[model samples]
Target: MAVHHETAEELVEEVFLFGRALKLAVGNSDSSLLPPALTGVLGMLSIHGECRQTELASLLCLSQSALSRQLSDLVEWGYITRTPDPDDRRAALVRVSDSGFEILERIKESRVARLSTMLGEWSEEQALAALESVRHLKDTFTDQARHASADYTLIAR
Candidate 1:
């Protein structure tokens, strides 16, 4: 049966709620010691390399003050490095630290193991199909987000 837009929205919302709960449980079960926002910042840096504070804040849909607070905490934890932008003395660029990458790797391993156990009953084909569907969703969402951001930027200018 074809899913309607309202059904899709409800399903996505439920998934997000469950995902947040799972993230909290994972955080409590392990010594990873990361907040959701910090994890997001780290993941973005890891994927995108260095980014200006403003750009990162825009991408994260966070206010300047909020992003600054997150960046400060990450820097203090040695999970992120912030350096003055050479081209713009007033701005800073942020990147994930080596320690950050190490922590991410550990977290990834732990999560993967947990998922493996959770999905152990599922056949390989089932797992692959699920992964493929999720990947498609992610890609579509990312592309739309980029387009929306671009439009917002243009309007702002």
Candidate 2:
């Protein structure tokens, strides 16, 4: 139990360092790239497919007005498209555009290449262990998020 507590603390510290390194890498990359705000909007759209503006705003924790501004920027950047909701012509549903998907692919490739370069000196065993650890951590967080949402729903009711 003591060992687990110490390991968790160390893992948290390392995760903060990893986040700083990632932010630095992203900031040093192409200026034309999407900012984090825009990335979040696009990422949610990509994950949820198409969703109404109100629903998207709620998911993003942004007010409808704030989301409107971001959505306008996304549309202007050719990263996303808004279409009239078939169910209710008064509302619009948003989704990533084809060009946006291409850009996303490029961004993904760049990050993968960067990570590969950074890991170049690592032994195969070390790299595999790190990968497995990250995968487990991600799964744990995902499960917790789901559980929290379920709990919130129950509380709200």
Candidate 3:
């Protein structure tokens, strides 16, 4: 565990940076079914697929009661489906629905459209150069982060 409160703050700062990067890269259009507040939850589900509610809550740093309420809302909206976990009958597994996938696709399309509009004023060479620079920055961060404190790896997703 990290002994310093500064570590917690730094971790949070990085998460915010990631969120900002995502907003810039994918256009921050919030679908009614998948509101901005719930983006991380749904995005995690989208990336990891079905998972038990307890595990999902742990991953999201949420309480089981809180996650259950949120999941209920998603299920009501048809954005996600909930089912009994096969291995644990008492537990539930949540998965994104087809409608959820469709909404995600639409959001991605909006991101592409927005990116095009933003880059329209830039010359092709300028845009390409910016892309390469961003890629290198990303690679540098990844490479340097490999030697971070072992606890960082535990908390990093």
Each model's C-alpha lDDT?
A: 0.83, 0.84, 0.77
- Score candidate 1 by TM-score against the native: 0.82
lDDT of 2 by residue, 19-70 (tens): 7887777634533677777777887888888899898998888999999999
Task: State in Å the error of residue 88, model 1.
Answer: 0.6
Global fold similarity of model 3 (TM-score): 0.63
* Residue 61 error, candidate 1, Å: 1.5
RMSD of 3: 6.8
Between candidates 1 and 3, the lDDT winner: 1
Considering summed lDDT, which 10 consecutive residues are worst modelled in model 1?
Answer: 24-33
Better of 1 and 3 by TM-score: 1
Better of 2 and 3 by TM-score: 2
Prediction RMSDs, each to the true structure: 2.7, 2.5, 6.8
